[model samples]
Target: MESFLETFRNLDTSQKILYVFGGAAVTAVSLVAIRILTLKEEKRKDYPRDKVILHQIGRGPFAPSMTPFAVKLETYLRMARIPYQSQGASFNIFLWTIRRHNKKQTWNQGHGRHTEEEIVEMMNKDIQSLSDFVGRKRFLMGDEPSEADCSVFGMLSQTYWQFYGSGYENLIKDRYPNLASYCERMKDAFWPDWDQCITHGGTREATK
Candidate 1:
């Protein structure tokens, strides 16, 4: 264990990042495999033809979503003009527990490897990269929004809206005004009824 720790500590920052993410990838794939092998297949739901049902994490009274991938997939569906209904709290509890465990393990590994400042610097670098890439462009890839926009916007929404009072909000709102503007454009275009979607966003009906 001592030798292993020493070796890990000796690795460069990029290598450490790669190792952490690679482990996460493996963990995700293993979870999927286990689920396929052990879980009984449910009878498929009958949706109207051409309609899709998205089982995302339940919406909070706060942010659009607590999970980025859920937001990403939903945003992609919207951008593609596909019809879908959002359902939440429908996932297997066992899988959810496993995910939480994996999250802790990943967090521990990352923080153990780097200082808080180092982590923040890395994150800010990523934000800057995104800002540089999207400078003055109406969308990520220029005039029209695409699938890529959905993915980026989903992740950015966390820093912009969800992680309030955490200084990450400033990363978007202050440090990178272009990214902030891009998020606003995406929200304005894709999620016009965003206010109604949240639990306390009034009794107004949320857009499907």
Candidate 2:
């Protein structure tokens, strides 16, 4: 320990600083390389690109208000035979986190009010916007499931399926029958195990 200390002390301040920086850089590079290598190996073992189009659906576990978007998107994807995955959670958590971190803001700033009612309203508006975009077309962008469909479905499914009894269900199911039907058909077609996907505790079941 004494020899190590002596050796370290022998170096000038700039050299010592450079040495620390270099060591940090090397460690960072090594960590990054390890992560890349690990990810590549995992990808090779778990999710091969040749198998399916790796798409993920995202939503919150509690906010059922996002259903319209999810259902519509799922319909388009199923019709177009686009393979994807669903990630259910609070719809805005990931995006809100990104916004907060990237712009150096708080969660409240990144998102609006934190009440369930507010969340439900936001989701309703978003879905309505998506529906308007879909118009009379059988799908979101014309008769085909575009890349946009995948994203829209992921968000919507979480809201509709997960937030069934959480006060948002009435807002959605009461007003959007087409959207409700769309969700039913999508679930029946794509996710036969719909009950299992219920991240929130089972309560208000999705009506067909």
Candidate 3:
């Protein structure tokens, strides 16, 4: 008998078409038969992929930013190579509470001026601290992003993008433009779904 390859090569076009299709059908049938004989049919169980919940720290009017703790958690998750789902919320309640306390003069009387000045001074100090930390690098840490950058970016994004907040008066833009730009860069890096992260409470998958 001719070798299988030689016999196939010698077949006419019509015969070859029939042979190819017939062989495919036979192979499919054989596979189904073997599967039926050897494989047991088990009910499929759906299990979600293991993932952590990423909690966003600060919530602005149109966007949700991270807190220092949230940033650290995010960095750790990235380093560990684990999947995560995020949820964003705001601190307006807490912020309003603080303002309420301030207005009541609970701390030092309802002296908005004094409080404003003190807050500005504190912000100035924060800017200086970041300036010292960043020096002449892309981020607070260096060329590579670190946990600290995440925290700093979250904080600065609030100051830069969030104008509704009490102290978010373009301070980052006026003073630390570098840091403002850096926040943008980091946002591009970490949060690819920028608008979605903000709109759907920071949880991209949850939106769907």
Error of 2 at 9 (Å): 58
Off by over 4 Å in 3: 1-49, 55-60, 66-72, 75-80, 87-114, 165-168, 200-208
lDDT of each: 0.61, 0.43, 0.47
Instruction: Order the candidates by TM-score, highest first.
Output: 1, 3, 2
Tens digit of lDDT per residue, candidate 3, span 1-208? Answer: 3322233345333232222212233223333443443334312423246877554423333334322344445645664568886544334332332223322332232223344455456557777788777777886667888766765664555455543324345666777777767777777777665564453422332231
Cα deviation of 68 in candidate 1 (Å)? 1.0
Candidate 2: residue 82 lDDT (0-100): 70
Name model 2 segments beyond 4 Å from true.
Answer: 1-109, 112-120, 192-208
Q: Could you estimate the TM-score for every candidate?
A: 0.69, 0.43, 0.54
Residue lDDT tens for model 2, 10-85: 5343222222212233223333444444555546655535434322223223332223444445555455767664
Q: If ranked by lDDT, best first, what sequence of candidates would result?
A: 1, 3, 2
Q: How many residue pairs collide in each prediction?
A: 0, 12, 1
Highest lDDT model number:
1
Expressed as tens digits, the lDDT of each residue in 1-208 for candidate 1 is 2222234345444344433322344235444554464345323545566778675544533346645566678889888899998755422432343344543555565643656467667777888888999999999899999899988887777667655334443657878989889989999988877775654422333343
